[model samples]
Target chain A: MAIFRWGMHFDPLAHLRQIQRELDRVSWPWTAGARRIGGGTYPPVNVYESDAEVVVQCEVAGVEPSDLDVSITGETLTVKGIKKPLPREEELNFIRRERGSGEFTRTVVLPNEVDAEKVEANLRDGVMTIRLPKKAAGKPTRVEIKG
Target chain B: MAQDKSVKVKTTVSAAEAAEDAFSPLVDIYEKDDGLVLVADVPGASKGDISVQVDKGVLTLAAEARFDVPGEAYSRTYLSFEPGRFFRAFALSDEIDRDRITATVSKGVLTVELPKAEAARSRKIEIKVLE
Candidate 1:
């Protein structure tokens, strides 16, 4: 039996099936179950505030500084890079692949606005540090009250 | 969290033999502001134990993965990435000052800074005014 409920609108079931098909095509990382597969899993990152700057450090082993791309807008910072995989033998068999590799992107939300124009990024010894100067409104200001 | 256990995994090579080919030695050349900075991933290595040797314009770096952290003997499995030996080598050109090379290691990562030679470095020259 042909089921047609709406007169002209698209079928609800068909739309849902199409959405599911689209979702399956997306590459989702392994969060809780199954083994994750990839070439570049982003390294651990740490962000903290100093006297005049917010410093962000990221551990990017096996990656060169030239390959990193950093961009900031408003109060958001994004670090993207690619970690090329080591050349492997054609017939080498692997039992488990724990290290995720390929291209990785890590986005961080800052607590306050930053001076995107004066931002500086330095990478040394597998660690990339980004120094962001806080904006005037983002810094702590002293308020005086007259009685 | 998984428990910390150190188990002796099966490797085709023995301990003494494995120590020889512990880490792969190769240098990655890169360009920086002043000169070139080479970053080598030498896991399980500590400061004051690694050496960067440059002889006849060829740079050879050596470092080992020596760990003292004790682990409980349990059902432990190891893979090829379980911190063994670290090694890397690179070639330098006339652009770099062979005597000015500096190396520092922190958190198992080695960074070698090769400043450009005086003649090779870019400098601003002042023009003399004519009478």
Candidate 2:
């Protein structure tokens, strides 16, 4: 039995990647520059914001916790890590090698000001989730309307 | 010669079975003295979300990510792809000990160890003088 199915025949994930590639090409006319920029960003990330905080999740499989470094400055969050390749025997032959391993650094700008001191991060099952608490002053205040 | 022919046939059959909607997870296969180890990058797949099965000399991996965020995404800068399910299969030959195969999932990576059958494993042979 097929465990997972999304709609009749829609693959949003693949389509999204295609669109992202096209956008990259348009922004960077130089194909070589685009390729170099793309290769460095090893893991893809998703950012979401709620009323109280902004959360970022990054896919970083095969990366050891010791090799990961996360830092925040002003409204920017930076994640850096190194993914080491698995050990192989001399006689071992690889039929397919799709996963790339190396050092990667990704920095994202937050939509709102956050309290960097209160930021929290956790790495589980190859996904790193970082939560940045929005500063109290940064939240929108509602004024009372006189009737 | 017969084994080689069968292997070629299996490869073609699997190639034809690839589907459009299914995304193949990036994988690295390594051969060791005991067996072959396949490491697959399946980010967002937790422990209970992944399944490994062997049917008719074929090994298949299916994984789905559990991502249910309450709020809408505000921005997407560098998303290689949206998080979703992934499927990949490999045609295992008769040399593999299907029963002894083992799998483990950790930090979004799946490692499958397919041990070679007794007859397929390498064994040093000793020769003595005929005298």
Candidate 3:
């Protein structure tokens, strides 16, 4: 939906934001099963939130650092990368294959506004962890009522 | 549950604590002309923490998932994964060279290589022509 008005620019990530909200309402691959739903969604993710920051963990086994791309755009954090396969010898015959390798784009809409300047990401043991600190306005505040 | 305990019975139990008291990690099995390879996805486990064993013609993969993050979650929003043990097993064929089997962990994925036995591998017999 587009609203033509002053200072009301068309939001491109609005649909992604809506999907993120729906994913939160129900159990995901972790609760269900770790099956590859699609080509791009191979690496499943889990999110954690605290008062200060939001930590995002992505399962990226067999993915290298050189193949990863992490960026924050407005209310969404996107991860683009490729999962590379191992080298195989000649005349190799496969009997069973369950793993997959391909390029993927995973975007998560953050619940709170984050400080992009302070965001940091690290990859280890086939898992990537990203920490995004919440902005002052995004942090929760306790309001006091006086009699 | 059937207590068949047979090798053909793919007791692929899901959810928790069926294989040696741990969650069964998903695996990919493929075969080559020489042998076979098993790839398992076990994130959050270090190289030293993961273990692979081939005993009694059965292969097993085990890893300890770690939580490096600190602080309790203020509110659970999208909690999908956690730190725990991953366990899975498979029955191997007799053609495999169990003595030469090896395993390694990289980027939290465990790869196990099982070479075929000498007698089991197919060899190209050279045809001798008598003139």
Candidate 4:
């Protein structure tokens, strides 16, 4: 059996993970008795846009500001960070642990053209907010109708 | 490697609470020398809005998770998550010293320390050698 592909490497884990991601997405509506302990995406984010700017709000609780890196290129915004596990994992007797820890990077495509220079990132109470102001061309302009 | 052990701990959801559909934040529980430490991810929940309570040998973590979003939302092409009330409850074993439990919230995480009672602590007996 050949696992080779034209331009992509054969990664079984990634494929399985993609399926699992879809399964989790389907369960989003039903919130009954589901622990949701298993890893979904880290730093869950909310995106909304206004006339002036488009903002992305992310949940980064327990993650340090120093550990995070946010960057944008074209229409994509990437957030990368490391959530260090509790100190001395082996030493402690864990009864239960659910919060997953490791380096995670999530990239999102912005809906509107934004002025990257005006982008502002702020961290407060473990939440990260990134503001991307709309460029002059990106903003909507009203035009007069011709007779 | 330690993940939330949903099996060992017993939990209950009242009908009223179930109707509310609270988000169960991920939690990690481990034992230290003196007590057990619970760390939970409750992003966007303010410190004042979180409530840690011990009643009838049950420990409950509840929080009102409020978030901030700028401007009126347009027809979003992509979305990830929603903010809601967070609720998780655990049946505390007798070994825990409920009176001494303390908690703190930082950023969007909540850490709770549940100390072990004096009688529940383990001690090693000294051995004597006679020449």
Candidate 5:
């Protein structure tokens, strides 16, 4: 006999996100040359906000630094790069392939303004970390209360 | 057989009993001249924290991502990070060289190399006539 657990708290937002992701997959244009397997984006990213700076980390294993391009326009930061597949013999056959390769672009809008000129980017061990300093106007101001 | 016993002792709970937060990492496997290479993306997991073990023809990958909470709290636009353990297992065939297997982790990616056994490798043979 198998026991199934029910009444687990369900998150509607999570379900919506899953539906959105599925829609994005099916809505992709098929006419874009040879259909790429597991195609959507090459590298996924995470964004963190602090009082001083906005940090963005991208997972880009096997991607060369020279092939990456990072640009910022207003509050949006764009990361573009190409992940080249590993070279193998012509007769080589893949047993399983889940990683996506080719060109990918990810544009994220920051919640607050940032100083684009002072942004710093570093790539280590395949992970790229970009730190953008928050603008003075974006910082939270503390107002003094008169006693 | 001794190695297999050790593996069983390490993992007492079955896969079905694992925590609900556990997630599977994305992996790509390729065949090469020497052997097969498995590349997995395990973001936030450092090289020292990741573990790769093989026992009884089964290969298990386990790792935990370290998350550092900042001083101040703020709202997030996209929250993808849910710190927890990443685990996966795969059964190997007899053609693989179990003893010669090697693994390395870099930039949050783990690469496992499984070499083929001597009898499994491809080779060319020449015919000789008896004089």
Candidate 6:
């Protein structure tokens, strides 16, 4: 089927500019920022590493450890999980939806080459941890004197 | 804009609070000699365990910050931490050297150094005219 090309289509650049403006309108936090939780809850996820492995830890309160899925292949590591939003009835008075829900995929590239065969992942206390072993080079290097 | 196909039970809060909470992490873009330096505020993120990824022209970052406060004593009255997965994505242009992009997180702050292509970096040239 032939597609219709109308010259009056909205400009993409203008739309992008509008999106930028809207993004700017968003209220931003500073170096130290946090939010208030109505009920008992934890904080945002934090990721870090150690001498032995490149570790990733996420604070997924109210979420079971079994719900998380982590995969690592070569330099790419993916963490896809779900956070079931808190349930409430009796029509919300009216406000905003800040928390992101449903499925989430977080992929990171390993800083150094890693051994895909020995990668390990663990989850406990609503925190998911992924450990990747660094690839080891065989044997130490030796130098010979030349005349 | 409100079209509801079904009624579902969910948490309902004020719009203003939600708006303020949504974009909690503020990202700063710095243009340096290397390329673009992105410093993002991931409050709970630690230097040892932050994830930075670049695919095609898209960049994604996620981290987890542990307070280490034992048990219920750390009851949050006003938790600035969103207490969930933090995600951010940026569509990069040719200005970024994807292969050379280096990222490091220190003290809950993430620093990403996007190196510029060799040709894109500014360099001083000597103009010598020979007869």
Question: TM-scores of the models, in the given order?
Answer: 0.39, 0.70, 0.72, 0.76, 0.70, 0.37
List the DockQ of the predictions in order.
0.03, 0.27, 0.33, 0.40, 0.21, 0.02
Candidate 2, residues A46-123: lDDT per residue as tens digits? Answer: 677767888788888878899999998877788989998776434568766778777888878776788989998888
Q: What C-alpha lDDT, on a 0 to 100 scale, does residue A87 get in candidate 5? A: 70
How displaced is residue B55 in candidate 3, in Å?
1.9
Query: Which residue pairs of candidate 1 clash?
Result: A38-A101, A39-A101, A39-A102, A40-A101, A40-A102, B25-B87, B25-B88, B26-B88, B26-B89, B27-B89
Rank by lDDT, descending? 4, 2, 3, 5, 1, 6
Query: Which parts of model 3 have CA positions greater than 4 angstroms off?
Result: A1-40, A88-91, A138-147, B1-21
Q: Lowest summed lDDT over 10 consecutive residues: which window, candidate 1 chain B?
A: B5-14
Candidate 6, A14-90: lDDT as tens digits: 88866665565564433122333322222333334434455444555334456677777666666767755334313
After TM-score superposition, what is the CA distance of residue B99 in candidate 3 from its true location, in Å?
1.2
Provide the lDDT at A83 for model 6. 59
Error of 1 at B100 (Å): 1.1
> DockQ rank, highest first?
4, 3, 2, 5, 1, 6
Q: Which candidate is the best by lDDT?
A: 4
True contacts kept of each: 0.03, 0.52, 0.56, 0.66, 0.40, 0.02
Off by over 4 Å in 1: A1-147, B1-20, B25-29, B69-72, B125-131
| Per-residue lDDT of A11 in model 3 | 67
